[model samples]
Target: MVPALDSWQFWAVLSAVFAALTAIFAKVGLENVNSDFATLIRTVVILLVLGAIVAATGQAQALGSISGRTYAFLVLSGLATGASWLCYFRALKLGNAAQVAPVDKLSVVLVAVFGAVFLGERLGPANWLGVALIAVGAVLVAQRM
Candidate 1:
């Protein structure tokens, strides 16, 4: 019998491909569309597609397992995602890819620090070092622009 791939592994692969396509497409597409509008359209399409999948898969029970607090957190996450995407797409439209990409990627470090501070997630020494490097790189990219 074939084994199923882990969910994180599947998403990791999918996200890598999607991220590459997003960068390329955002660069090209923004030439024609307003960047903030483009981000909204993309997010709306994504939510619709994923929502339909959840409905079609009879996953309402899975969603029901989430508590009110978790639901609130998820909604808040979606809101923040929308805001961030709008900013990133605007940057991509107005700035060079080299600088915009690195500065946008700094969200990784921001999220890690937020998780450690608010979500009770622990960042070990190595993770701290990585975050430091990311910060330095982001600062250099922005400064050089």
Candidate 2:
């Protein structure tokens, strides 16, 4: 028999493999399934897991500690995440993951722009250079397809 990996090692490897599979499977599944329905199912599964964890950990009161601003952020994040999932899955259906992933990473540039415009944030010169590199990488990957 093969040697078993350490639990942490197993988790790391499993998570990476699962993440790649998520893109691949989501791409394939979205070909036939409705993206919105798939997102609903995905959200339900996430909520079930989180609820179970809270119940098991006895952190039920943690819910009361959540502030209104935190709740608003969570709701906005969830909506954005769901929208991203829909787009990613739909893109996967249309194109290769190799191509889709790098293009998806363009969100980094968008995030930086958002931070600058909305959050009154600024990136250093090195960060601006990094953004340029990211854009070039994404462009090359996308153009390859």
Which candidate should be chosen as best, given TM-score against the real structure? 1
Candidate 2 stretches with Cα past 4 Å from truth are 1-19
Candidate 2 global TM-score = 0.72
Clashes, model 2: 0
Locate the minimum summed-lDDT window of 10 residues in model 2. Answer: 1-10
Which is the leading candidate under lDDT? Answer: 1
Q: What value does the lDDT take at residue 134 in candidate 2?
A: 94
RMSD (Å) per prediction: 2.7, 5.6
Which parts of model 1 have CA positions greater than 4 angstroms off? 1-4, 7-10, 62-66, 141-145
Predicted candidate 2 versus true structure: per-residue lDDT over 1-145, tens digit per residue: 3355646787778976887788777777777777777767777988999999989998787577889999999999988998898888767767888899788879889999899999999899999999989999998988854
Q: For each candidate, what is the lDDT?
A: 0.85, 0.83
State the lDDT at 143 in candidate 2: 84
